[model samples]
Target: MKKNTEKTVNIWDRLRQSDGQSAVPTDQPWPKIWQGAEGLGQDFEPDVEAGLKRLKAKIHAMPVAGARIRRLTPLARWTRTLAAAVVAGLLGWGIYLLVQPATPVATWAEITTQAGEQKAVVLPDGSKIALNSASSLTYRTDMNEAAERQVQLIGEAYFEVERRPAQPFKITTRQAEVEVLGTSFNVRARAEETTTEVEVTQGKVAVHHLIRDEKVVLAAKEAVLVANDQPLVQETSPHLNRQAWRTGRITFRETPLEAALPLLEHYYNVTITWQKSAAPACSITGNWQNDSLTEVLQAIAAYTGITVKQLTADTYQLSGICK
Candidate 1:
């Protein structure tokens, strides 16, 4: 279903003709005159009176329109030679494409972590990435010249990118592009967080908003929160939480129940919510260790007095008293 343009056909023909009966060297060291006539599909006749006499009487009689066949001229013979070169190069490129296997489509690497498990990955370029619990990153294992480093992160990860001065590393999502050069950062793009969050622990990064055509640069200890219709880059405050799931723990400092629910689900792989009437106003203030799902839920219920209801393998319902 690929279209072979006239240009392509002509180039192939020239390559074939140039091969002729004699076995040409694989090196293809065509004369400069032949090299010059590349794309124009020009033909060449030898100079010198005797060569021209033979060309005019024989194989060179018919001239392909718009293509100059070298005539016995003291004038513009070089023009036709240049055209020949152009055609040869195009043919060579075509041959290369035909002989070579189709390039493989790029895809992301798959990474998964068990409930309490973590992993560290050293990328092809020597960059180090750590994946946290219940997290995964998809990226191309093969690095090519066309695209440097590109990966997609789901859940949370800590990246220690290797320094590649010429190639800029890029992390892409459904909404944004995070560009960096040899920096450490944590990215959390959870399905629960309403927004994709990127926090830089060291070095500098630029986050570009895909929809708004906006770009924000973050320094060390800075973070950007990107959500649908809302994108913000703010100086990280002291009250800010840890972004790395592997090393740092999540903390709730009198935060509302609704705000804390998403984090709990992400870490424990279980869903927890609140009864309608008590949900918005109920606040939670406590430090939860890396405890089991039941223990964490019990602590929350002890503070707010809301009953935790388990619905299925992965779903839960919160109801009853909050006051």
Candidate 2:
């Protein structure tokens, strides 16, 4: 029975130590200061009640006036409770604001095609771009923004830009800057070529030379050739065969023999050279179906009287005097 009584006393002592009372008075001006906080004291209801009970028990158990033991009263304990509530409220509000998702922003997409591969992409602005083999184009989907209507192209691409007079569409490339109000144009800037070429199909396009600060305006069915280093513009005879590349077709209408070799090399991915001591100049006009490079070469050989022989996988020698 004695041991049971001692155990009960030990448990109560532990509880008192764990929930100790404050050392300040309750009726001081500090309590009124807490009330002056505009209901900040109201936020401490749970803590104030718990602390008040602890203070009451402590004051009842405290020794007489001559003793050194300190006691806790209401107002001082309430001040501490209010401070804790304010900190917790701010922390809670901060956590709530942090967990919300951020608003999405406009973005751009880049389209590219490898060698021997082509792709057609429709942009968010309803403009269509037919990327040729070994070409790349970058455009923004949110072109509705004033600054987002521009596109950058590398290698070669055929653009059918959507018409927007207020928001003009611009295509920046290595050789020329092609800007259009609304039009279709083809840009080719191959590494081997000494000049960048632009062919306009429909509507009008303004071509700007980056180095020269000069501009050339081309109407429908017109074209311009720009040299790599020279900042000069020259009009060129428009070749319908050039536009054929967009459809992957190699069409030559009365093209010179030298000029035709490069077109065949680009399309068929084969080297075609003359075997004779002096290569004869010929104006070749023919249309071969976009099929195997061998068949196309064979068709050209059969009609043009040039013997076609394959030296390696990619090397083809065209030998025969023009008939």
Model 2 stretches with alpha carbons more than 4 Å out: 1-108, 231-237, 276-278
In candidate 2, position 159 carries an lDDT of: 84
Candidate 1, residues 1-323: lDDT per residue as tens digits?
A: 01335455565567677846545543464543354545465565656999778878886676668986555774467777888999999999999999999988875568888776789888888888988887778877776454578888777778899877677888876567889988998887765555667788889999988766778998888888777677565657523445525645567888888878877776666766666675658888876555667777888889988888888888888987677
Summarize candidate 2's per-residue lDDT along 1-323 as a digit string, tens digits: 44545665565556556646635433356534533554553546367888889999999997788767567678878998999999999999999889978855767678888777888888878888888878778876778775538888877888898898988898887777888989998888775566678888899998988866778899888888877668655555677677666775677777777788887787765677775544466557777656787887777776677777889988888887666
Cα error, candidate 2, residue 40 (Å): 62
TM-score of each: 0.60, 0.61
Q: TM-score for model 2?
A: 0.61
Candidate 1 weakest ten by summed lDDT: 1-10
Q: How many clashing pairs does model 2 include?
A: 0
Q: Can you list the residue pairs that collide in candidate 2?
A: none
Output the lDDT of residue 193, model 2.
65
Which regions in candidate 1 have their CA more than 4 angstroms from the true location? 1-108, 113-118, 133-135, 144-147, 191-194, 228-235, 238-244, 307-317
lDDT against true structure, model 2: 0.76
